[model samples]
Target: MSSLDKRGLKERLTAGENVLVAEGYLFEFERRGYLKAGAFVPEVVLKHPDLVRSLHEEFVHAGSDVVLAFTYYGHREKMRLIGKEDLLEPLNVGALRIAREVADKTGTLMAGNICNTTIFQRGDKEAVAKTRAMFKEQIEWAVQEGADFIVAETFSELGEAKVALEAIKEYGKGLPAVVTLAPQATDKTYDGVPMGEACRQLEEGGADVVGLNCHRGPKTILPLMTEVRRACKGPIACLPVPYRTFEECATMQSLKDPITGRREFPVDLPAHLCSRTEIGEFARACRAMGVQYAGLCCGNSSHFMRVLAEGYGRSPPSSKYSPDMSQHYVFGSDPSFKKYYQEGLIETVSLNNKV
Candidate 1:
């Protein structure tokens, strides 16, 4: 195995280097038919270990600097929701081990994952305690498996975000904590805390990196993230869903079908995915704004990741196969190409030319 972490994630970020993290395991695995969409628990880590490892490899090849564990929704509450509370410990351990193996082999940072419990309600001390316990076990397993950092992501409630940060500080064994929140359609956390103030609080609470992830797409999230960048004194992480969220529908959940006017989220959002070029543009924008850490959240794929890498001025392993339209048979301008082929290509391929 290759040596891991020549320079740690925090070290690189502190040195002004951008670290690309590939998340979106919940949606990616569901699309692959291994994970259930509604529940979204990462049983694939235990049931389909090879697939999980393969995805980690794909992200690494596509230029991801961090191999985030596929434990996004593998918390105690989520597992218990699906009546597999028995699988909680095994699932978390299995996911961490898979991520560690890949990170070690490829010399990338391995990040343990935790997300919102969905059970935490503000001012409810009982719910807060339950949330803490859930985070404690996951952090314990992550630290035990040698994770380089802990990524607490997709929490829409700022209250819960602090709890996750607190848990990380207590149980993370001094590893870096990357806490990213998911603001709702209002452009604020579910608890009504503005995005900037929320991120500011996280940084003040000792988070290594603070920003937003999930829910909103690139266009919608960037404006709020700008506020975070200005508010926080530390590195900021921005990983938006690869979708084209607009003014009317500022988040994937708020997206509506053009014809049917029905909701198209979770399972029916393929038509709304952002093109590779769009992702590249988003990456370039982030870099220009001095954002230190970047990546895509849900709806992320390897090709999309390659675009992000290239946008950030990186050429990952997959870049070797990036598009070379100049070499296309129908559009080639190379000297060796037949002039007749290029001249008639539009006429030959155009549907409008058909009799």
Candidate 2:
């Protein structure tokens, strides 16, 4: 089986064939030392080939029409963070190869995952420019390596999203591109740019689809989607993070609460985790709100995605209690490094050569 051509992707999106399901932890590589940064070890691809393959098959079995490859942090900068810059291309190519292999086996469409840049700050023109170049180079490589389309996920800043879109336009060679933003609790970016503005900017910058991802949770993103639909005409996608439970928040606060009486203060839990039921509901809402695509983000696993697929045409699930820890990990330390170096494994996995 071959990858979907541009015409095929355009037809799929236009025909309302959206609703992608993410297979979480597929791209998570083991790290070395306890605190030392680790590399994007090849073992993730080797040891988890069946895991990746099964995930693609499962999402397809669950009725999801699209599957995203495991290439979230596959870029050079992100790889450098884990001391695996040399493995960037191999990691990215392996991800696409695995996705394609699974798609060929299951007949599901695949979207190459080209996530946001490592940097989140805005106003750094030089850095942004360099990032755009990197994005362009990466997208070109993905296309050459055989990606059906591209999805740029977890973008918190519109400028970064714009730069990514610009890169796609320059190197996408007309491949379909979907852009997803990570809005703040106020339904805006960290820089205060409204979600609607960000959507519009991405659409203007040549994205086929513009939407939200990795935000607070389904409930918070629901309201934000309304604002985005109002301002943008392109297709939209919503991939919310899992909501936090009350006890989880309390436990966290107990651990981090420095002030003696701070724990006594009312902690209004921010809506975070969207259960399978809620995810399904959100997916339906997205379809109603003119969003052509919907999926899950951080802390969301294949099981959540399965439920999302099952709830494709239903009302959104009720909002559960969640915490407001969205900003806590904005610059948090990397945790996957410990497993990588501990194993001393670095064997590359080859594609099945069916593509």
Candidate 3:
């Protein structure tokens, strides 16, 4: 709409361009106090639409190539959990409209998003039907709202992910779909499918891009991406939460506070957040592995997104604020600084370094 290139998600990927999509909306909105964290229903779309739009604008300016609708957990189940079922349609439509506005204004792709319904049951036929219905309605709204593509993400089970992809293909009516799974502590879907096989299956089922997202952080997720890249033939997406997860705490949900020895997920995870350098490292690894779709999940910020963009060989508008430590009073080497006032600074720093 802003006279930017009209290429869709699939076309850009096909043209060998890496796409950066900024997600982590649930956590970001909660941190900003616009949405409640426990239920994470995303009613902010209906209550404070301007905030959602501003967040989308921020992500675009920080180098996101897509303005993904913040419809995560805006489904009937989540609404019912908070007794806001009446706001379901309005919330979904509102989120889509807000994202559409940002995408049009920023000339970024607008993506309609549907995530795994937590109510999905492996063997319960009724539950499975309900899950499909949830996906169907959201996809319909996304299509009707003129979404450029669909993103069905964070499915913890491979079966549920396939259902989402199927619904996207059926209800999306030709819009490309990006399906990403969130593996649990065992490095596999809750249903026991390995991450790589799961992504491969999604690719076979017609997902334009298939890979992992959320739940895990860079250290834990990057190793899994290796298998995903090897198994999938088409584009792969890697969007991990910006936390410091490792073998001990394989996923953020399992992270423990070093001092308290209690799980610190959802809340109190700031203590373990990954540095911008780590996120940049993740982006470099993603580019090296040929991950066509790269991004951060929960705990992402505009600054982190900028670092990721730089690591991907992109200079987003927000990069203008990237840190320049060379100007630090104690560490600066700029010739214009008066040497008399800072002559003893380097000696003092060296003395302090002595352990």
lDDT of 2 by residue, 215-299 (tens): 3566666777888888887677777665642333322112223344344211221223345566667667766676667777655
After TM-score superposition, the amount by which residue 282's alpha carbon in candidate 2 deviates from its true location, in angstroms, is 2.5
Evaluate model 3: give its lDDT. 0.91
Which residue pairs in candidate 1 collide? none
lDDT per residue as tens, model 3, 189-266:
899889999999999999999999999999999999999999999999999999999998889999998888998988
List candidate 2 segments past 4 Å from native: 1-7, 26-43, 244-273, 314-355
Q: What Cα-based lDDT does every candidate model obtain? A: 0.91, 0.63, 0.91
Error of 1 at 68 (Å): 0.5
TM-score of 1: 0.96
- The lDDT, on a scale of 0 to 1, for candidate 2 is 0.63
TM-score of 2: 0.72
Q: Give all TM-scores, in the order shown.
A: 0.96, 0.72, 0.96
